[model samples]
Target: LPKTSNREAQKIVLRIKRKCRETESEEVAVSIGIGVATKTEPEQSIDQVLKEADNEMYQNKLSESRSTKSKIVQSLLNTLTAKSNETKEHAVRMTKLAFDFGEKLGLSNSQQHRLSLLATLHDIGKTTIPEEILKKPGKLTDKEWEIIKDHPERGYKIASSSQEFAVVADDIYAHHERWDGSGYPGKLKGENIPYLARIISIIDAYDVMTHDRPYKNAISKEEALAEIEKCAGSQFDPELAEKFIKMMSA
Candidate 1:
């Protein structure tokens, strides 16, 4: 106990981490944050040593949380990409537009980060949809349309399953909600929809309109912007849609 080196302490921590992971349950993965402090001075009080270790442990916890969120998000994206390359590319494009719009609208850094995640992962539920239905060349039947509309709920459940993704779960669920309360899963109207979800709705509609999909050909940027303007206060939030139109028109 008197001569333990930092290197040896780190080795011990790694061993513990590995063991924790190895013992993880199939349904829930195990993660740990560890902190180690060495007594470099004979005069150091036990209280001081404990305090230092506690501080280190807190910092490690924050770092571990961020790392875990990143890994889970990446895994979801990979799974989504495997299901549909078009959707993945759409997410990439949407993320850039989302950040730019967030900056223009003066959203806080944390809000912007949340918006970005929703932008990319909002359609994660589509991974559960049948491929033929998702890529149908023509209009869907009423039953198929209902099936498609169920994606938001599906996405919400997937996001809610992980602590890291739970932050955006509500937004993912409400992204399709209409300003007029006509949108799916919940007929949440006006300000009842989550703010980030509102932001996503406007941007997502714009992106989808301007891009070619199996069901529809791409429209011009001008048309897309106009459609956004027309849908304001109905399909999209009037204030947010106005801002989006101006941002794209600029």
Candidate 2:
């Protein structure tokens, strides 16, 4: 093919790949390769050009696989935000607070990134709850509360389903865990709980307390902070809660 035509073909192929990433469709696994050699180059073998294009396409496929998982997780979170009573603004606020707390604790950059993602998607499992149960304007029955408590495990399964998210799965699973071995699912205590999970637990609770819910009035920020302090060493990790309070104050 002519060089101009070859360039145009490459553009089209690249555009398709971009669309695959945007849509995050299952068809992304289908690899397509295009090799174009200048019609004027009689010496260049078609086989060599084909091999080069195939190799490039293979590399792109590998990259897309990694990006695909991230896109899927992100799409799930978007759906959760849209469907649940939890507003996207709440997720954004919690993420910022968690990130800031992680930074104040001197966590590594990678740790902070993971904490941020966990905070943003921590309540994603709530999407699995029935709308009637989730949006009930009154108090929940024991059975309904039991069903609601299963969200952390459900979230863990969703996150761990992808290799890219497996690292954070435990954190998601244990976000509700208490420091005194009283929390649900695993009831992991102290350092036994994933560190990021503990951090998220404190921030998540604080956010919920400060924000108005359908069932409860929003408390003052000071009252929320005081409530968090009151729960330190029981519902929360004492040290982390203290550090988080300080970060919020600062």
Name the candidate that leads on lDDT: 1
Q: How good is model 2 by TM-score?
A: 0.73
Task: Kindly list the per-residue Cα lDDT of model 2 for residues 159-237, writing each as its tens digit.
Answer: 8866778778989999999999999989899999998999999988988899877678899989989999999999999
lDDT of 2 at 43: 79
> Where does candidate 1 clash, by residue pair?
none
Question: Over the full model, what C-alpha lDDT does candidate 2 score relative to the true structure?
Answer: 0.80
In terms of lDDT, the poorest run of 10 residues in model 1 is 23-32
